[model samples]
Target: MPGGIEGFDRNVFINCPFDKGYEPILQAILFCLIYLGFSPRIATEANDSSTVRIDKIRTLIESSLYSIHDLSRCQAGKKGEHYRLNMPFELGFDYGCKQFFTDQRCDKKFLILEEKAYRYQAALSDIAGCDIKQHAADYQKAVRAVRNWLVSEADIVADGAAKILGAYADFQEWYYERQLAAGFSEDDIKDYPTSELLAAMKAWVALGKPI
Candidate 1:
C-alpha cells in the first residue's frame, strides 16, 4: 500500500527545533526512528511555497499516528532575545487535532521532550500533568528516551539504546570519511539537506549498518 495518512501506522511526525545547535539531537531522533523501522516525517520535507506553513504542519499532524515534540529550545539564549513559541505552538496544534478530531485522530500518541525535567512547566504550565521526558541536551539520553517511548507506544522490539548510540557514533565516523572521499567539502557535508541525510541514513542501515 501507498504511504501517508492512509498508512499512518508507521508515520511519525517530528516537531522539534531546526536550528544548527539542535542538529545532533535531531539526527539522533531520526536515526532511532529509522533504525526501529518507523518513518519520520517533518515539516521541512515539504518545500512548496504556495502552501501556508501552518496548514502544512496541520496536514502532517493529521496524517501521523505518532508525534514527538521537543520543547527544549523554548527559552531564549541571549538577553533581549525572544523565546521561541513555534515548537509549543505546533505541539498545541497537534494536541488540539487529536482532541477535537475524529476517532483516528483522537488515537494519536505524543512524546513531549524538554532539556530538563519540570522546566517546561515554567513556560507551558498547562502541560504539568503530562509525562515529559528530559534529554538534558545529551544525545544519548535523547536516543534512550525516544527508543523507550517507541517501544511502549509502537510495540517495537529493537536494539537497546546504548547499542543504538554506539551505532550512531560509528555511522558518524563512516559518514564523514565517505563524504570526504567523495570530494564533498566540509561545509557541503555539514549543510546537507535533511532529505538527503535521511536517505543516506536509510541506505546505511540497509547495508548491514557497518560499525
Candidate 2:
C-alpha cells in the first residue's frame, strides 16, 4: 500500500473522519484547474513586421482626439444647462445687450442684460436634463455655443481680477452684513442671490482657495 489516501481501505475512506486539511487541498486543486482552463493564449503564427506596424497604426487611430470621444453622444454642462453634441449650434446673440450697446443712460439696459444672463443660465440648466442618447446632437450644439461665448464674450480681465485680486470683496461684505442684519443665520443664506454668491466665490478664489 502507498501509505497515503489510496492506502486506506475504500470502505474505511467512505466513513473516515473529516479532515479540515483536506478542504484546503481540494480547494487548491479546483483553483489550479480553473486557472489553467481559462489561461489566455496567442492565436496562430506570430505577426510579421508589416503586420506589427499595421497594428500600431490601428492603435494610433483608436487613440486620436477624433476617435476618442463618441461625438454622437458627447454632452457638455454649461451654466446650468446640458448640451448634446449632435444638436445644431445656435448662438444666443440676443443675450449680449450690454456688449452691443454702450449706452448706460437707459435704466432698463442693465436690467435687460442681467435678465439675459440669468435667462441664458436658466436655459443651460434646462439642457442639463437632456438625455444624452436622444439629445446628443443638441448637446453638441449647445457646447459649441457655450464655447463661442466663453471665447468671444467672456470678461476675461474683470473675471480674472475678481478671481485673483479680491476685487469682489465689497459685494461679499455687503451681502454678508445684509444677511446678518436680516437675522438670517450663516446657513440660511447658503443659496442666496446668485450675484452675491458668485461675488463671494470670486473673493474665495482670489484668496487662492480651491473652488
Candidate 3:
C-alpha cells in the first residue's frame, strides 16, 4: 500500500457514486481539487480493462495522502433497491490505512461529505464522531466544502470558494465553446471522456484560467 513520495502528497483519492445524478458534484470536486493544486485520483481513472476495481481503489488510497469520501448516496433511493455499501466500505479502508500505517502514511488526511448534514449518523453511526460536511446536493456547497477542506488540511494558500466557483464557470464556458468550435454537438460534449476534460482543466489552469 506504500506509494512513491513524489505523488503521495498531491494525490487525492475521491470516493463517491458515479451515477449521472452525481455528475455535477463529481465535477465540482474535481474542479475544486485541481483549482487548489491537487491531483484528484479515483478508481474510474484506471482504464485497464483487466484491472480489478477494488485493487485499483486500494492502490489509489495507499498512494494518496489525502482522500475525500462522500457517503451521501449510501442509502437506497427507493424501496426494494439495496443501499450502496461501496462508499462506506472504501472510506473504512482508507481510514484503516491511516490508523494502521506508519510514517508519512500516518499523516494522511480525510474529508467526509454527505448530502444532508446529519443523515449519515442515523445509518452509519460508527463514524459518528467524525466531522462530516454537508452539501445537500448543492454543487456550490460541494465546491465550498472541498475548497475549505483543502485550504485547511493541505496548508496551502488559495483564493476563496467564490473565486474557484467563478473560475469553474469560466472553465465550463470556455470548454463548451471550444468543443462547439471543434465540431462537437451539445450532446457530444457531455459524452466526452473525463480525462479529456481534466486535461483541458489543467491546460486552462496553466493558461491562468482566463475568463
**What TM-score does each of the candidates earn?**
0.93, 0.22, 0.95
* Error in Å for residue 126 of model 2: 22
Indicate the residue-level lDDT of 132 in model 3: 94
Residue 19 of model 2, lDDT score: 30
Tell me the lDDT of model 3 at 195: 80
Error of 2 at 90 (Å): 5.8
Candidate 2, lDDT over the whole model: 0.27
User: Cα deviation of 6 in candidate 2 (Å)?
Assistant: 99
The C-alpha stretches of model 3 lying farther than 4 A from their native spots are 1-3
What are the runs in model 1 whose C-alpha is more than 4 Å off? 1-6
Tell me the lDDT of model 3 at 109: 95
Give the C-alpha miss distance for residue 100 in model 1, angstroms.
1.8
Question: Could you tell me the lDDT of residue 179 within candidate 3?
Answer: 92
- lDDT (0 to 1) per candidate: 0.88, 0.27, 0.89
| All candidates in order of lDDT, best leading | 3, 1, 2
| Candidate closer to the true structure by lDDT (higher is better), 1 or 3 | 3
Per-residue C-alpha lDDT of model 2 across residues 99-210, encoded as one tens digit per residue? 3433421111100111112223343454333322221223233223322222333222223222322323444465567678989898777535433443444444455443
- Can you tell me which runs of candidate 2 are displaced by over 4 Å? 1-165, 194-211
lDDT of 1 at 116: 84
